[model samples]
Target: MTEETAPQDGPDGPDGPDGPDGRAARPDREGGAQAARPAGPAGDPGDAGARRGGRWRRPGPQQVPQPHPAAKGMWRGDAGGPFAQMTVMPGRMSVRLRLTLLYGLLFFMAGALLLFVMSVLMANILGNVKVIGFGISDAEAAELQRQFVEQTMRQLVGRSLLALGGVGVITLVLGWFVADRALSPLQRVTTTARRLSESTLHERIALEGPDDEIKELADTFDAMLERLGQAFDTQRRFVANASHELRTPLAINRTLLEVALGDPEASDDLRAVGRTLLATNARHERLIEGLLLLARSERELTARTPVDLAEVAATVLEHSARREHDNDVAVHPELTPGTALGDPVLLEHLVSNLVENAIKHNAEDGGELWIRTGMLEGYATVQVENTGPVVPAYEVERLFEPFRRLNADRVESAKGAGLGLSIVRSVVLAHRGAVYAVPRPGGGLIVTVRLPPGQPAA
Candidate 1:
């Protein structure tokens, strides 16, 4: 380091760490000035101990000269040389910015065009005034008329040019505003999308107002994110459920086979083990099939015709009434007339899965189930609530995912594959609907489904 003058003020400020003035800027070790210097390849000098409060006193009239590292990069210098010995950072001109320059150029052109037009108009007026003011004899009358005709033509041309210039300016202004308005929604969607992660999938980009292009764009964007969130949720649940379900059966079969080969067992014991394995295998198959169906529903993009959601709910009740051998739930319906436009197959699946889920999770000792359907806004909604054990609030969202089951208490048999809720969610999505499973107030679980209604096409 080059030798330089140390501050004449002893470097340490008047205030100390515990002083009334507050902590000083001087290094604790040096008891003098605290200066940070750029390090060299050789090594940096020993740094003084940190000041208690990291305050640096403002240097007085005297200035301290410090060395700054010379910038070394492709853009370090311009044709004129380095700017005050500081490197010029390279910057890029984006397409939008470059296009903006054309705007400036057109602005200049419009000015030029107006000036040229005004000049010609003024010249013609001056010429006509001169012709009318100057005296004319019989011999010069024809020449005067010729001059008048030429000036008249020039005046007409100037007027036309003025009109064209005005049109161009109007066009440019309108074009700029329209283009900006068109892309505004896209900008909002982009910003929200960047902030989105697995944790914030619930946030939506719902554009309000009339069904214009920007509104439509926002709607489409929200739908895509919605689907993605669902897919991720389903995948997570499927993996967990499949692992749990498969492990149970494998463990049982291994134990039974080991017992039969290693030790003598009664005929009844062996048969019972075989039956358990068979039942587990059946559940495994159902889980796999459910997973496949959910995957297919998520992948579909085409919209389906609108049907009556209330009717679909009623059909599902029929299947639920006889699904389980011993599901003794008392089902009641509060049906209302409504229409819904969506995939019929998916709609049916949504209703069936929800009601079946409601009944299955309830106790067989006469659990109560309430199925209600009615017009909700421009669509139809069905809610199936049943009496059962209380479900925790935090786990409500996860239960809709494939292979997700809440078994923290471990009270019920954990052997069944956890794909029912996942399927319900997937089918609901295919119908462009929403599904939520909540702990029913006063009793059981509530599965709510909402679908858009279809109106007659114009």
Candidate 2:
């Protein structure tokens, strides 16, 4: 017997030695093998290939495909698809209103269903009643009975519908009241949370009610506040104690350095070393002071009085005049009446830091500085603009962080410790105000501060 060879199936299974579509593979002009498909009814080779392979094919220039009726509202950019449209609500409907409406709708539906059932039963019962008439034809009596049943049903349905409408209105009103009462506890929680901050962490919800979900949430919030208050208190005490302990040693060192430098017979090298040590000591003292001020500003102000921002800015400018002249920076002030409620010392510090920062970071020669203080939109406003090297917009916000400066390598900086802007921000926040900075157009920065307006001090 002759050796039998089993035929191997093509990749698509049990097909002849051809392409997946059962057509012989032919080499194209590009020397690539492709299936040779017969033309379809439209006599287009591409169409035939698409049909044979069961795949989507782009329409030719002469052919345009019509959209199906079902796809009329689908994939539209302006109107959006059905699923996207379904997610859009008609307007701003609060949860409480939605619940109330839902309750009223359910009641209305139940009432309508009950009316329908009663009407049907009444009609069946009236239809079964035998018509009893004296001295009248049975057919006439039956017609009269039919008319009476129709009239009675009409009156009953009308009255029932009217009653349902009145009851639905009352139901909506009651539902609204109930929803408001139900959500009142949540509203309290929200209000307390909004009013509480780092300074007011001692405030608690202390909501008194049955141990339900809302009460549980309020209790949890109160517990969080208690823990936060403890943490903040501990932090404040540590900072105060550390600063006090450090001040004594620094003060002693400064006194010793001054005495050593004042010695008449001291060698030149010894004198130079003493002066350097004194400068270093002064810098350390300034750093400590900055830290203490920062801690104080981050806490709630215990005392507040009307402080004129324009007067504060004028004082700062007077003190900064020598520094500005030495740096070859020009100061332009536009001070008008702008009073705010805050601690005078902290507000002065805020203005001083801003003015010093502006002068220190100014251009080498003839840098211009502008300081404006006035009432703006019912808020006391102070704005400072200066000329200096270009500051990137992305780095503006980081300047408010403690120990952060425009230059990454700040250790060797002769400028005061990198706490100027940080202190300013703290003071602004302590006063419940806002401060922001933006990069100047050509090169430099513009810092603006807005505080709650206060009455002039009498």
Measured by TM-score, the strongest candidate is 2
Specify the poorest-scoring 10-residue window by lDDT in model 2.
22-31
User: Which segments of candidate 1 are over 4 A away from where they belong?
Assistant: 1-168, 171-267, 301-303, 324-326, 363-365, 408-415, 455-458
lDDT of 2 at 299: 78
How many angstroms is residue 33 displaced in model 2 relative to the true structure, after the best TM-score fit? 67
Off by over 4 Å in 2: 1-96, 123-150, 190-204, 322-327
Q: What tens digits encode model 1's per-residue C-alpha lDDT throughout 37-101? A: 21111211111101111121111223221100110011111113211122222376543444455
Q: Provide the TM-score for each candidate, comma-separated.
A: 0.45, 0.71
Q: Write candidate 2's Cα lDDT for 297-381 as tens digits.
A: 8876766788998899999888777563444788877676678778999999999989888987889878988776765434566
Instruction: Give the candidate number with the greatest lDDT.
Output: 2
